[model samples]
Target: MRNVVYMAVLLIVANEIYQKPDMGLGVFMLVFTLSRQLQDITSKLLIGAAQFESDINYMKIFFDLKKLERENIDDTAELIENGDIKFENVNFSYPNSEKLVIKDLNLTIKSGEKIAIVGKNGSGKSTFVNLICGMYEPDSGVVKINDINIHNNLTAVRRSISVVFQDFGHYEATIRENITYMINVGMQVLKNYFN
Candidate 1:
């Protein structure tokens, strides 16, 4: 398109020079304005194309996650009476990584037991907590709550377990308000379940 514009401008300049040499200044201004507009349009097109490709990649990831969720779905809602957590030879690694974050880990935390997972940076402390919370499944073995496999039934685990991460969200609300907000959400879920 720029080439076509340049060719047209050249023809116009030639015609102006042949008819009236005094119109050379007007022809130069027209050419300059057209080139600037062309540059602006080309830049906008490039940016839009880049943005479109990024959105497509994002959607692909979104759909892949949705499909994974569907595969792991369990419609039955099992209420957890005891919060006992047991990890039996659980082995796990992050997706696309060969390094095992949690390897052959066997642990048991009976209900009402207080425990702390302490480790240095890059250790699997966070990964272990995620396993307990049913956020990620073990590559081998099982994570169980009250002897029930959490990967097959997550609703029970979600209702009974709550973890506060180091980077927890800080809403601009009072402590009571923040606490009550989660209570209200739970109540709404119960109401919907009964209905």
Candidate 2:
């Protein structure tokens, strides 16, 4: 309200001064000041609009995830103490493609044993890891932990398993985030003993 009164007084004074026969320069100065103020206001609005658009775009990804369908398999297993895992004559292919990504795969890992998989790009390494983690079902044959098929009891199998995937953007995240961002223990990350 105070600013409005001041502006009205200034405009009344300017109007009286503008009526003078030789005040063309005063008119020019008033027009230039108004134009500069308008530009500053418009520029601030434009910046706020841009920031709002960026935030909406980032939030849309999480909204889309909430609408996604979750897999439903109603089976849980006993707690796995031995951690013995085996894949017997497994074969698999992704949806919408006939090409087999994993074919005739077989393997076994006794409890507390360490194993490494190495391959060139497009090899079945990631696919094999996904199968072991119960992310995907084997199209044929069975994946078992202590003779309990993963398809029969994925919830219990996953409870005892921890997997660190290898891919672009897999690293470069904070250590707490690197493990699925499950914790926020300040900035420091746990050391990768292998690295």
Candidate 3:
């Protein structure tokens, strides 16, 4: 609307200058051209803003669904009294990838078992952990926690395991916030250290 008003003003000024045969006719033409260019710029900005808003709406919907799934998993985790992990004939391919990363893999970890997973880079080591952490689902087969399917009881499975990734990032927040965020514990532990 503002752009339309500015364009209208520029046209009126250009018409007046032309009718009067004034020396300022060149300046009016320049102003008119500039106004038209500005209108085009504003139109593009509005279109970009609309696209951004649409993207944001999609993200919100995705996050909301994720939150609901997380809540359901947490509820299921609370029911588990023992910890166990199992992967049965699992297969997965990344989005848009032509190759499968894990093909018909099977593994089982008993409650309180200590296990080490070793593989070369891009050998699906991280992919296996990600699957266990509930970050990605198997394209086929099933993962179980304590004999219960991880798909059916994701919360319990996640609660039974802790993982520290090799590619973990350091938070640049205050020391207190960083520790609290990582441990997800109260601030009282830091108070004694800081004191």
Off by over 4 Å in 3: 1-81, 173-177, 184-195
Computed on alpha carbons, the lDDT of every model, listed in order, comes to 0.77, 0.70, 0.73
lDDT, model 3, position 127: 92
Each prediction's TM-score versus the true structure: 0.52, 0.57, 0.52
In terms of lDDT, the best-performing candidate is 1
lDDT of 1: 0.77
lDDT string for model 3 (54-130, tens) is 66764575446435422332422374667678899999999999699999988888987888889899999999998
lDDT winner between candidates 1 and 2:
1
- Measured by TM-score, the strongest candidate is 2
Model 1 regions more than 4 Å off: 1-76, 170-195
The stretch of ten residues in a row with the least summed lDDT in candidate 3 is 68-77
Write candidate 1's Cα lDDT for 25-102 as tens digits: 777677767777877799899998987786676457544643542333344776687778899999999999999999
